[model samples]
Target: MVPIPLASEPLRIGLLGCGQIAQAHAAALRFLADDGVARVSAVADPDPEGIRRVAGIVGDLERSYSDGRELIDDPTVDAVAVVAPTRFHRDLIAAVASAGKPLFTEKPLAPDFSTVCEIADTVRAAGIPAQVGFQSRFHPIVRQLQDWVVEGELGAPMAYTIRDDQFWPTGAVVPGHSSWRAERSQAGGGALLEHSIHSCDIACWLFGPVARVFASTRHVFGFDVEDVAAITIEHHSGVVGNLVTVFNGVRDREERRIEVFFERAAVEATTDFIIGAPEDSLLLKQDGAPAERFDVDALRRATFAADGFDPNREVFVYQYFGYAAFASALRRGLDPVPGIADAVRAHEVVEAAYQSARTKGAANVADLRSR
Candidate 1:
């Protein structure tokens, strides 16, 4: 019998973005710095000034680069975090794969399926660990819901409903803010690429692979791409899921919930709660009312127990766990959850959704896989 190896070495991390999401990643990396588990040894971004500013916030990054290739080629950097922009993911991931270093990257992997598939193949051939930054999956409720789905708690999910609605602030300087997003060459799609990826991937993680899809989307806000979209997905396990994404700036965000309807009953878990059900539907609820809420404190305790984290520890929240978990997986030579192939699948779905909307017909994800 072979003894299980423990992850004991500290990881040397290189960060490659200086944007808003990069700040979140840096916040997570900073927590690891405080814990002595890992450190951001180097940084890089197209904007030298932006790299310097982020380095200042992260406390003395050893090297900075205007081009990410330099940082990837740096001998001392053990792993890389590619957060530059959606368009840059494929190139950065390729560089990291060629260098044979582990990677932690932001979502959707790349803007095109062909490029995404190529990157996935390269990472697998290099045999280096690669983790995608779908950090929201670490949310306690989501974790529990996935657990329940796998454990047959919901008796095999029959349907999944996703509502993703939020008003992206106009003041923030996002890529294509003025024109980039509207251009097809820059942003793959509008809301589906920029925002729908989160909900779509979460759906894949919680339910299963989306086998086929039908969707409708349009440029409601005068953007070149759709600002709102509706999609229907058929999961491999024969489950059906419906997703609605919009930027209507509704008075409240109702689109943040993922509700799974099952044979036994239903499970509704939002970021705010681990469970929601009809009061009369289960033993966990109150009277015969149709709605009940799960407690946040209890969910935190559950997460701490499973992850070996301090229940009372105050840190960078979910992002820190994502970084730490990916680092640990890399050290063990295991591909971290949501790697390059998953990104390719995500992009396929995004493209399928866009095409279905335009053609008014169901789109097969496999058909887009060739592109």
Candidate 2:
């Protein structure tokens, strides 16, 4: 398909929720609007106060709806930005697919692997571009790393290591607030599904598909679900990907980072920077030497955060580039970096990871394929 020119008129967008992540989506839409390419046409939420808050962000001229279905059915809206809870993802995707509009749903696509397949099949059959909100792929360093790998810069990675550590402060989750994140029925798994989805997708993108998975989950922090997890995966290329997901505040680690070891040389790329090659000591290092280093700004020619690596730990709170990329793809026929199919695959990985953790054995990826 020939690539269409960027839309001359602003693409009309609507939000399905007004939660914390939804604020980031709205900010991204505002950024697009500043460029004269997209606008937030409407917002929908059951809470009138929440609806007003989101609507106020895009201006009062935008439409507001008490029910998301009504907003989804609105004829004026061209695309939908779904930042609702994980539980609502399947229903919202199905609803919007039936409505015949492009969609961008936040990650973990649904509560489980089975529901994710239903959403994926629905979007696929409808022939519409439905994007999963895996924003880290849009990070400049990540994109460059993927490009380098695909271009054979690293000479085919033999293994991948991903580490993500976050501290979900106790009081951050308001009590009696009825948050979907705290409920297993809504979030599926805790940190594994909620936070690990990003790392899982990155693993899949770096290495083709998952072959097998062995994982473990423990509620070390006493949350409703597991707060710490260790997952080991075998990719189709026989490459191994080891992932460590932690929600502890004790360890001092980067918020997100991936280290890829290839046949030619090893490359370590983080959300803020990338380093490799003999020039910077990336490959020629005998012991503890700095390699070639590429900072965030040096990558995409656009800087999302001012302070570089330590910009903001709350990644989802300010994910504009990704949402803009998704909006552009849906409006102009470009491919979103991590679309709904990727989400389905990520869900499959998470499900397998949890199963492996429970059974204390390896889980075949093929066995987890939804019916």
Candidate 3:
């Protein structure tokens, strides 16, 4: 399908949900709107309060719907952002694709990766532009590392390690506040599926696709879901990596870090700067050589904080960059980065890890298809 010419008009974006992540999507759309790339034209949610909350940020919507299907049916919406819960993803994505509208959605695409192939087939048949919310791929630090990998500065990642040390979204979740995370039926799994999946996506990007995994998971927080998880992923490139995630930690900070050991050099990066975070740091060291360090500009999040634009971490800023990249891709008639295929690949690995944990044995990523 041909893209609507950028010179013609801005794409009208419709939001499908109004939960916490929806707020971040609305905020990011504001940045795109300012540049005439896209604008939030409609929003839909079952709860009036949710609609009201999103409307506060996206401004007066051209239309509002009690059900997301109605919004997808609205011809006025040029593209849709499916920010609904995981359980709704398979159906919502199929609906949006059936409508032939380009769409963006939060990651994991499907809960247990069961419907991924069906979703993939539907999107391929429709040929609508699609992108996933793996915003970490858009992080400046991640890009810097990727560039080095391409240039062979970090030659063929001999070993990779990613740590997603985060707070919240675990233990004693308030019933309404992302409590879906604790529900295996709703969210699919705990820390490994929800949090570590981001790092898993990074692992796939930097180290190559995961071929197999052996995992151990624990329900340390009594959430009926595993709050702690450790997984060893073997990438097809002969690079083995370890990812550890825990949601039970109470800390004053969050750290999203990656370290890659190459043939002769090592690279380190921090600052997946989600919201109201400060500067980020990156260091590269080679054997018996001086280490080089650099500071990555976190899209003026600190500047916004210093000038009082947003003093709270609730306003996510990195996603602005990710969605902006997606918007540009839409205008150019190109597939967006971290697109649906990427989501499927990441989910397949996550599913394999969970299966391995359950069976107390190794699991192949491709085995998700049979189960």
Candidate 4:
């Protein structure tokens, strides 16, 4: 495997794509700049306005390119973040891997499972460190849930339900603005792939690998993609769960609420879909006991106690914890969490769901994984 150079200087990150998500990463880089961890040194976007807006957030970037490949070729860029549309991931990941740069890509890694596999293979062949943006994995409530699972506090898993909803990303939602997400060719799939891929990842993380899935989908917004999907998943460990993902017309309404039940306890957590803050809450109720609520800040402090950074001072929105963790891993020359393998597994589950939707029966996740 290629080794990341141990450097005292801040890691220079080249950002690809300057859309809404790119802007969030820019803001995160700005936050991490205070600790000398990383900074946005360059940005690439076909849209000048996007580049300009991201530059405004990051401030005084060393370089900007209309083509992402140019940014990948720039020697000064220590690492690269590919925030471009799903359709463009395959080519950009190939380019980044060829250049031997550590890469951070937003999910879904590609529009389809086969392409995601191709990109993963490219990265593996190049032996470069890679991370995929399942930022929810870094959410404080999610961390606590993971801890609960590991500590057996939740007892034997019984069932779960995750509802992920977001304001539809179309011109209708934001007047005069067009979203690539409205196109199936660009976004791969709607609701399920574009949004609740995070939910799929979180489910697998908290439970176990999904064994099979049965799904149904709807195109309520009349887009080429499905704006709603309801999937039932059976895990390898015998836990069963339901996930509902929707891209609705609700203005500025983005939310995810998860409720998981076990033999000994039940846990429920709620947070904003795109940006989770310290004030988000999680509640736990053991058998014959009252529900106890915990704010995200308390969980964050408890989870990251050894990191030496105070959760109160840092901005928790824009997935700051995820980026901070990425920067720290790069600086330490360690592999990042929620890596490409995690992304591939999530995509496999999503693909299986889509297949089950089409076949009108349960689809085996292992059937896709075997390929």
Winning candidate number (TM-score): 4
lDDT of 1: 0.72
Ranking by TM-score: 4, 3, 1, 2
Question: What is the Cα-based lDDT of residue 314 in candidate 1?
Answer: 60
lDDT of 3 by residue, 14-48 (tens): 89999888888888777667666678889999999
Question: For model 2, which pairs clash?
Answer: 280-291, 280-292, 281-291, 282-291
Q: Which 10 consecutive residues of model 3 have the lowest summed lDDT?
A: 306-315
Model 2: what TM-score? 0.85
Per-candidate clashes, comma-separated: 3, 4, 0, 0
Collision count of model 2: 4
Best by lDDT: 4
Off by over 4 Å in 3: 4-8, 174-176, 273-276, 298-316
Model 4, range 1-371, lDDT digits (tens) per residue? 33478433577889999988887899888877776777889999999999999999998788999999999998889889999888989999999999988899999999888998998899889888888889888776777778888888669878999999988877656875567888888888999998899999999998888899999999997998899999999999999999999999888788889898988999999877443453377999998888898766666676555456655655645456677777778767788888988888899889999999999999998899677
Q: Can you give the lDDT of residue 130 in candidate 2?
A: 72
For 1-371, candidate 2 gives per-residue lDDT tens digits of 23433323687877998876676677667766766667788899888877766666666436888899999998888888888878887888889988877787888888877787877888889877777788767665666667777888457678878877766523435443345565677678887898878888888887888989999888876677778899999988888988998877563333776777877767775552122211111122112445665544333433444323333322332356666666567665776757877877777789889889989999988988633
lDDT winner between 1 and 4, please give it. 4
lDDT per residue as tens, model 1, 205-245: 87778889999887766766677889999988898998888
Q: Which pairs clash inside model 4?
A: none
* RMSD to true structure for each model, in Å: 4.5, 5.4, 4.0, 1.9
Q: After superposition, how far is residue 81 of candidate 2 from its true place, in Å?
A: 1.4
